[model samples]
Target: MSVDVSKIVRSHEGKRGKLISLLQDIQSRYNYLPREALEVVAEQTGIPLVDIYGVATFYRSFSLTPRGSHLVSVCLGTACHVRGGREVAEELERQLQIKPGQTTTDNEFTLETVNCLGACALGPIVVLDGRYFSKVSPARVKQIIKSARAGKEEHTADGHVFPVKVSCPRCNHSLMDFSHQIDGHSSVRMTMAFGGKHGWLRLSSLYGSFNLESEYDIPLDTVVNLFCPHCHAELISANVCPLCGAPMVPMLVIGGGMVQICARRGCKEHRLDLNGVNV
Candidate 1:
């Protein structure tokens, strides 16, 4: 579909400096930046093509090429890494036959990696269409993908479903976990997996593949950081609140998991049990 690029550019009020915002708006509408649209923006805003391209490449959030309908983001942070994130990634690549930063042949799904999802307790998690799945295995990956293609709802007769939660200290918003807003129109969530080949956080049923494990070259005790996808706040790395700079305290939830809330009382920029918080 050929979009009216000039209109989108006008949304920025023809401000040449708003190229980044203009591009973000266009990407949200089309899922990828079209060269035609970019050219139109250049013509309307008098911004050079080189400068616009620079901004697009500078952000990992921007995709120059077309993206699939379904985005599959796998987490590769210290916790998920230690638990077996790499193997899960490999399994996804094998099943989808597409590596990280690639899309399936039919353009049904795109597989990519984020550094972390902060659901350490739910290591080895897999998110599909913003929903979370904990303790995923390669075999389970196959089932999930197949089920999606076949238009079957995910009925984990053998797996566990845990909330992957996150929060924003800046806005006091319970940041959507595994979710990152790329453009203004739509937001997406990333899935996380373990690395060490040993995890099944809160499994309920017996899906045959939950017990599967793979070997890895890296150690499981690596350190990492978790950032808020919304406001880009540092939720877990320094053990301090990203908004107020107060120390964070670990508090237990109603069921069983723990969360790190801002220690500052008045500036309680903290949220709880919201999927994908700093784990």
Candidate 2:
């Protein structure tokens, strides 16, 4: 059924400030940029439909079509590339029978590739359902997609799903409060644009070229702190840990730990030989 653009737009009082918020709310309700909703947004804001669409499309965050039940994203960032991100992504596309920008016919899954997710250390990462799976490989891609399709289990890299409460490293406040990934894997769309956090991870994929941004100039991806070095323990971003309650220290720990270096076997966490002693 077509969306009632006028009604929806009118529902929002002509408060210009509330336009963006209203659109976000509406898009959330429909899980897409409904034609009717766009009409409403355009008419209410006195903005041209073309302008509205332009805004929506310009931002990588917005979607124009209905999303699938599950979202699957493969990282093509630099670290992931060095670790075979392209291969993993290709494998996914082959299995899903859909390209990066297309959704499956049944709406079961939508597959896309991102330049990076700020987990460069976790190259070749795959985020399914908003959960990050690092060091992904062709084999792992198969398993991840299978698990998601099954819906009977929560697929995780290294075959382990730790109940970690992810948060922003800078602000100790709850990160989930500001998190906007809608259905995890079903909602994320990846684009390779220069001067973004994923620039390093997107060097090879020159789908389109533009002025190159500086290495450090780009926006750094989310910094995850207070995570367990081992076991992928869910740690809170507080000074005194939430689970252990120990004085939290910022440690560069991702992919579970040294044993589980990343989601890939090649980068499997290993014992560090410090001073000839296995530490």
What TM-score goes with each of the models?
A: 0.54, 0.53
- Most lDDT-accurate candidate: 1
Candidate 1 per-residue lDDT over residues 1-279, each given as its tens digit: 334666666556723235554665576568788888878877777779888888777555567788887767666668887788778888988989998777888999887776655457677766665445677776788888888788665885222233333223233344332232222111222111234343211111111112211123223332223333444433331234668776543222222122444434344344321121212
After superposing candidate 2, which stretches have Cα over 4 Å from the reference?
Answer: 1-16, 155-279
Candidate 2 C-alpha lDDT tens digits along 168-275: 222222223123323221111111233333321111111111122222343333222223222323332122333333332221112111010111111222111000
lDDT score, candidate 1: 0.53
Name the lDDT value of residue 58 in candidate 2.
49
Best by TM-score: 1
The TM-score obtained by model 1 is: 0.54
With candidate 1 superimposed using the best TM-score fit, by how many Å does residue 162's alpha carbon deviate from the native? 9.5
